[model samples]
Target: MTAVMEPGMDAVETDAASSPYQGYVYAYPHKTAYRPLPDRPGLRGLWAGEPQRALSLYIHIPFCEIRCGFCNLFTRIGSPEGLTTAYLDALDRQATAVRAALDGDARFSVAAFGGGTPTYLTAAELTRLFDIAEQRMGADLRAVPLSVEASPDTATADRLAVLAERGTTRLSLGVQSFLDEEARSAVRPQKRAAVEEALGRVRAAGFPVLNIDLIYGIDGQTVASWLRSLDAALAWQPEELYLYPLYVRPLTGLGRRGAEDAGHDPAWDAQRLTLYRAGRDHLLAAGYRQVSMRMFRRTDAPDTGGGDHSCQTDGMVGLGCGARSYTSRLHYSFDYAVDARQVRGIIDDYVATTDFTRAEVGRHLTGDEPRRRHLLQSLLQADGLELAGYRQRFGSTPAEDFPAELAAFAARGWLAEGDADRLALTPEGLAHADAVGPALFSAAVRADMAAYELK
Candidate 1:
């Protein structure tokens, strides 16, 4: 880590402040912060008194045909014979138990299937998965904005047909790159022909929204090459596009390359920032509006799916072992694992188990933590946080509760007050979100997350 000599700060303090690529803060209080709950909390207690009545359902399919080099998600490679069938059976049992826990009053307005790759299941298996949501839970997949993640290799025509038949509004395909060399550089091992074929099939599937995910900053990737990817994605006229910067994390294939090359280099950081600007500007010119730092949606794309449920505060029910269920009080899931062997062991444990209800491992949030989460989630968006709405919910403004944090950002030219009741980040500030996010992490949460052991 490089040290920055900040004015009025000692070397040690500055060094801690300047560490690059600390960690990606997608969800508040990172999953690594959770610990095993010896007395697993039943769903009733977890959801009891949660103000929000409507819920979003997240179903995880942890099987993937291929594992990428930089992937650190909770998933494993292809399952052995009969494992898929058994997994489905267990998933149904869990779903049934969870549905009963929710009671008749609780409603599901949004549903999604995400994973190593949701399309990893066969067309018939996909049918069974939908049946659990529709028949068992009464959350009509046809009525909600259902999204499913897939990869080019696994999104077969038959599978796409099944998804189309079952009311899938959005189909997200992880087309990391258009260049064959870059794919090889990232150890993703995909060809241009295959990606194009997958794109064609997804479009033919007739989902209301098509999201294409592309990655930049791979080894040997250049500004010109990044624009080529942008241009290629634009050719698809996708409803949404997400550009992700490459991150190498522990236990990943690329993480084991060498000690010297382990973390983000100063040179690589500069390159990624430049390429991010290029991609952002290109998308803007192509009539796509930035949603968050990474997400961009077509200006005229249909927003007919996924009702106005905000993931920041809404309750979510997660069915699969890898899936995480979130309540106002806690976020819980099965034990997380990254290593292939460790993940396999955990999967084995999950399959052999008969109990399909309650939270096994999770972290309970303190009162202040929820307020901080509200700030982090709202502040990171392009639209910024609404000061009035925040004050109405929490009885205090963000500026009042987190004065030092907001002042520090403002002093650094990263923050801007807009339209009287809103606060937003300048483009430069959004570029530094990774740095700012970690700074906002409570010391206690960070310590717990750091101390947790990975299986």
Candidate 2:
């Protein structure tokens, strides 16, 4: 059993040695807020230079059975079935548009159906989606690992079979916490039997991997309770586990129930770290490899091994509304704008000419104003840069361009030297990857922030 520190005491000190605020850390301003930047004219040059095939697809079905309190997905709550019907058609049309843009290239390494819950769709709806995706992209749905996100309530046996038949090898079940009280308090009221039944059904259906997501650091959750949740979750034998630390976001339900409002411990931040460390230790002992900061997988699991699963870095092509694609040429995202009228417009655009482009690609990628582009990709994953790859892509070496920055990280025990090619990040570096990227591009971020302040 995990032990909880006393209520009045500090679980861990927030001094310079242990806090996240230390170091010559760079902070990245929100990339989402910037207006579409001008497109680069030499995108074709970048594509020809980097002929890496699109390895994955992320299709966002933004409709949930019920909106969870902490969820920030781009979804509409309690949307009518008629709206869903319309949305499915839009998804197919959108896929055609994207495929047309790809110029008939359809071989993707992985495809993920993520959302509020892809299983929210009826069997027929899902089948139709798969059929359309295959037809348009010439996608080998059967060959690649297809992952679908679902909740316990929707992962019924029949639905699992339907998904299995549709070539989905992976299922991501959102089981935030096993403790009923904690789950309910967090507004994710999951039933024990339902979770069990769903896991059994999905596993029985021969899903290659069953990943269960768990949340720790919720208010009223102690180390003991969190451990109990972990124990119960392990009992289910999930192939992978994703543990996330809860953070407050503006306008979220949990955010409004602030630390001050919740009459409990010394402070929320103090409790958060304790729960995080405890959960990490427990999962590590249970033979789960910490794949990323918030993700873990069984060490011996064949399908979902210790590697990056997020589409952002893995050459993924996104379909459906609000789905984003990071290609060799440019990064493009589609949103079925919130209004039904805007949705109709996007659908019409898709039907009229099966392809489209946006100006954001140019704005984000173009122009050589001595751009100090941060290595957001390397920073997000603990994976170190291929020094040769960097030089070949940008025609500059890290040591030559930013020696002081590299030295600063090395001084902090976060950097490890590699043989003439890779400058690796140690485990400590992985834990704080998000913070390091900003420092790498400090000049650009600071200038952007300063501009924001002036405005």
Candidate 3:
């Protein structure tokens, strides 16, 4: 499929047509665009006028048992003596300050614990983390849909018990592959037996949703192996599944090993696309519905409801050094890095910090950025964007605001034919979600991301 670029469109739209796996667009104006806030605006002032009724709460833990080859996340391997304790102490302090800043008006509609791995902590430590969220941040986990991430090794029975007892609605386990060789090839060393045991334990704990995450395009992975992994996960009858395409990014172990060459290889792209379609079809045939490019939910899965918290408009309060907080106009966080040494340094600085009242590093959303964010986040979902909602929010339709981009997408056959009420992606468009997403990035954001210096 060829994407004919409209005269005024950015070059990224052209690149999107050729390279379908450019990058994952999980969030707009990613952390790479953030800069030091010289004025260090107070958190209270940032949240004063922002709506807090349906806020989302997030807590980040930066320690992991081992670093995977394809990982470029801001995390370190292993917590040294007293490191976890100090980190928790800092988390508590930050939560206290942020809660005070919200001025007693905030109410969380959903919450999440993500990281390196939230379950890397001991069962008792998990209890303490929950207490801090409930006590200091005033997030009632029991009342909200609480999601947590876990790894196969850390999803122990005790940890699962603690998570279930504390009202965790979803537990997402990173089981990249069911085959041990493929797991090792991806630098995630785990046996199939252990993964199965962990899955059994998670099911026994009775969480509302069990999400198994698998990665396609791993070294030596073929269509058959990918299906095997998918079938293995299906055998467990998980409520959700996330199939991620392997990305060998700079600063990650795979990048250091020169594995990034495969990312640019046309043959590799074809292989990944083939594998993605096979897996997508298999899941759809097995009674799972596509939620996004990466997420698939079982048709009969229990709905853990928190529909009020909209990522495009709702405010989010993030605690922990690795977490990012979002208000209507600004997104803020502490320093971010993928290098091990730099990550440890940031964590140490976070632990030793006393005050948490001001925004240190962030980007302020301005003008059309909010509209772009709303459009980008909404369009990527399988449900697509409601034109009426967009018009109601911005007083302009997407067609009026983004005619050229929409035309370019239509040229590439990435857009679905829809009535005036909705705009959505075609199946091929969802397959190339990474490409479609980056193409929509604003020019200023792209420049900011490009200029970021990696540590």
Candidate 4:
């Protein structure tokens, strides 16, 4: 792997070798890799020759009731006196501009409202949000699958009602732990009683799919306690479950408390891996199927039927201060930050701006980036990447383009055996997903990410 280095690849490989938990590669070429686009290309020009149908629509709400210790997402702690209203007004304006830029041929196959917490808004505000998506952006929420994220406190009856009425196919609740002590240890500060009440409300709301998120490897968290949390969530019989490892990154509450190097601790890594395997086997025995390293679904759960839009190849229209829009050639978003003050500053600028028609900060996908992204995202899934599809799209096989990396994985016993038509990972390989994801980073992206200063 070192011999095939392209200037900046060594740093990432070294980091991955130090710890199996580097970072979560939810999206390739992370926001840290994005820089100011000097050309500031017009959105119309960006979309003129691109396909518009079957696009994914994303609306980001950057306000959360409270900031958890392990959280480093782009969001503010709370909305000031008029901040929520002002933010919604800005969202409406941005939606109008984006809709016009699409030139009337845009159609959304799926939509999601993520954040901080989209349910942080009042019921009336949520209604206005749906109206903006439908009336201004021309996205018919009822015609597509919509997913929304919520915290326990914000999953009120009124809010849940509005979500159910407006066609929310999936409601994901972030219940990091079932034990009160564990929740406090994770800096989530939620009571078990409140979480139960929230889950009951979500079930009463009658959404087709309910997803519960849990966390493993918290301080003082033992294997027995981890199983308790998993069993607690299983009582809900949720359609989906996302088990996330606790990552204490820079600027987060845990990091500020001097726990930034927690992931590098060998003991901590072993604890997380042990807990992850326990949770995985527990779910599999309970009749659930693994979708990815973090996601699992009940075998009998109803299919929400929004598989038309593929994140690997389709375009995405994102609206908000923290949202990101993806085109085949570029991925763009507003300036990103994790510090509370810097995040607030960016939100203020987003609200004050009138011209939302040009790209401000972005990264262009050039050379073999598209291929790397396709392989990275697909191979991470439980089904893995199909060999024929790779050949059809790029006119080259993964083994041919990434001989050294593939050989390294095989030597490490990460590659699954006897799967000639698909490139998949072994069970142990899936356990080290965080490491595998970072190891595949392009040199240019790694360099840019290394250079980015975390405000």
TM-score of candidate 1 on Cα atoms, chains taken together: 0.94
Q: What's the TM-score of each model vs. the native?
A: 0.94, 0.78, 0.96, 0.96
Give the TM-score comparing model 3 with the true structure, all chains together: 0.96
Q: Give per-residue CA lDDT, model 1, range 1-455, as digits (tens).
A: 00000011011112223543445566777767778998998887777777445688888888888778777777788989999898889888888888877767777889989877889999999999999988777787888889889999988899999999999999988988899999999888899999999899988888999998898889999999989988988999999998887777667667657522534477777887798889999999999998777889999999866675787778888888788888888889888887788888887887777876678988888867888888888888888888887888789988888888788888888887556879888887777666666667777777776676655
Model 4 agreement with the true structure over 90-143: per-residue lDDT tens digits: 999999999989958789999999988899999999999999999999998988
lDDT of 2 by residue, 1-455 (tens): 00000011111122222443112122122223234444523323333333335456677776667656665455545454477677777677666655655533435777778766788888887887788768866676787778888888888777788889888877888888877888787777677777777778888988888888887767689999999988988997788887765543323446456632332233554576567678777888989887655567788887533223333334446676556555443555543242334444543443343334332222244432222343444444545566776677678877777777677777888777655777677777655543455455444434543343211
> Clash totals for all models, in order?
0, 7, 0, 0
lDDT for position 160 in model 4: 96
Clash count (model 2, backbone only): 7
Among residues 3 or more apart in sequence or in different chains, the pairs in candidate 3 whose N, CA or C atoms overlap within 3 Å are: none
Which 10-residue window of candidate 2 scores lowest in summed lDDT?
1-10
Model 1 ranges with Cα > 4 A deviation: 1-20, 259-262
What 10-residue stretch in candidate 1 is worst by lDDT? 1-10
CA lDDT of 373 in candidate 3?
91
Distance from true location, Cα of 306 in model 1, Å: 3.5
